[model samples]
Target: MDQKLPTIKEIAKRLNISVSTVSRALHNHPRIGLRTKMQVQKLAEELHYEPNTLAISFKQKKWFTIGVILPELNEQFFSQAISGIEDVATAQNYTVLIGQSHDSMERERMLVEAFRKHRVDGIVLSMAKNTDDYQHLEVLDKYNIPLVYFDRIPKGGQALSVSSNIRSGAEQAVRYLLEKGHKRIALLKGPDSLIASAQRQEGYTSALKQHGLQLDPDLIKEIDLSPEGTRAALTQLLALPQRPTAILCFNDYVCFDAIQAARQAKIRINKDISFVSFANLPICNFLDVPPLASVEQHPYRQGQLAAEMLLDIVEKRKTITDIKPVILDTELRIF
Candidate 1:
């Protein structure tokens, strides 16, 4: 049989006091004497009394819980970002509910709906790779729920977001490869749906133009970020009449796939085709031959900033109109 749980009424009955008195004493109300407070607390502990969070949430009009959604948890960059988010939530005495969209737009929409139905205080999100619609996110406005996006944010500055400067990072990456005497450099970019991909392309184009070189659309290829997509893109780049001496990949994971595909084709990494990438992930250290360089996007810091911003809005520390988008400058880290 299941054990009966003790309630404030039971504690009051045992102590021969009113339920209101027991409630006030348990809360250590100033009106209650210290002796009475201690007595109630002692008996409550003996009975293994646990306050009903559901009741407390109703009374406070807040759940004290926040939802976090990401594209992939297994990725090192996202895993580190989650750690940063949890740290901030813990300090604020908030519970975190996590979900993975798996880069699916439908999954992302469903998670948002579920979180909204659960009445979470706010949400932090890194949009899925294919998420082009914002109707699901805009629905949060009806419920007055705050949202803060990080890393893979939507394409506008109107939304509260924390992201890295991918355009500058991409420009720096290409410039570094150019200084190394690589004129024929290829770019393995992400799907065009991602704003980051567009930014990277802009940076790549800007760098080439500055060096008196014309932008060659033939040297650029787009990938869906899947290993298969990356390998296929690599194959196309290698088949070009003038093979690229170096490649700048979307990020470290894409670079890893590209490197593997090159090795399989009997192409020597770094010698035949060097590589640079974004997201200076720690996993790069474990690889026998990582990218020649990586752009630091500061995923963990972006997560922290996103969480803090969402909490601020939820707690009424700041209004939506008072907040501005946060964009961190990127750094290129040489291997």
Candidate 2:
């Protein structure tokens, strides 16, 4: 039979020290002298002793891990956000665990609950489009767990958040189209339930009013942030009595699909119709008909800010009163 591994008790007995003393010395407690700690550590190393993570966690009352919940990870936007999160987390000596909601409310709730069960130090969330009720997030409050929302945030405020100025970005896109000699412009908005979509629509409407362009209710189309939805929305927009000369899309994926639908319908890009999309994805370059313009929401910066906020909360480096919402600015990426 294989020899049983030596326990902390065995080490204490062999060292002629009390079990409590040995445990403190092995953990490098401040109360334990350096000589005793060195002796215990050297003996433990020679004995091939491994500290139990459970015991360590019990003592520290922390897992030193963070949970990141995202709507989708397949998109370049979220991928870049994760990159920023990883950078900050690695530097701070914290581990990051990821969970994807797949834009489903049920999945989002499950992920949040699982993270709570795991007792992560904090959570960074980019809410799903279908997420309506935020009572699940109130669980974090109930548990005294810190949560920082990023990109897409929950409705109703006082929640900590780091995001781009979505309304300003949308307004800029709409204003650009109006300046391009396009009178009848259309908008491809995300689902209405999404806070980001609502904010963007508000900006779009504001821009239209600013330019003396009547808000055409028929030109505003709301669809899911999917290629299929974009295709369907574009089909409907093109079939309208007065087809728009330019369309503002929700994001790069929608723009890709809209371009495809336009081509299939024999509509020329940059001449017959133009488009401006948000989230300047890499795939935009590979598209047969690229967007006329795109918005740079600085997703990487948003990620960095969100991660920094979470770490600050964990380390108690700052108080909630000192914490302010970080709203990064956007720039128009003209094609």
Q: Best candidate, lDDT-wise? A: 1
Model 1 TM-score, all chains together: 0.93
When summed lDDT is taken over every stretch of 10 residues in candidate 2, the lowest stretch is 280-289
lDDT of 2: 0.89
lDDT of 1 by residue, 218-299 (tens): 8999889999999999999989999999999999999999999999999999999999999999989888899999999998
lDDT of 1: 0.94
User: For model 1, what is the error of residue 191's alpha carbon versus the real structure, in angstroms, after optimal superposition?
Assistant: 1.0
Model 2 per-residue lDDT tens digits across residues 1-335: 99888779988998899999998998779999999999899999999998776777778787779999998898899999999998999999788999999999899999999999999989999999998898888889888789999999877656899988889999999999888888898999899888888888999999999988789999999998888888899888889988999999988888888888888899998789999999987777776668988999888888989999999988899977789888888888887
Q: lDDT (CA) for every model shown? A: 0.94, 0.89
TM-score of each: 0.93, 0.88
**Deviation from truth (RMSD, Å), model 1:** 2.0
Q: Model 1 off-target regions past 4 Å?
A: 1-3, 12-33
User: What TM-score should be assigned to candidate 2?
Assistant: 0.88
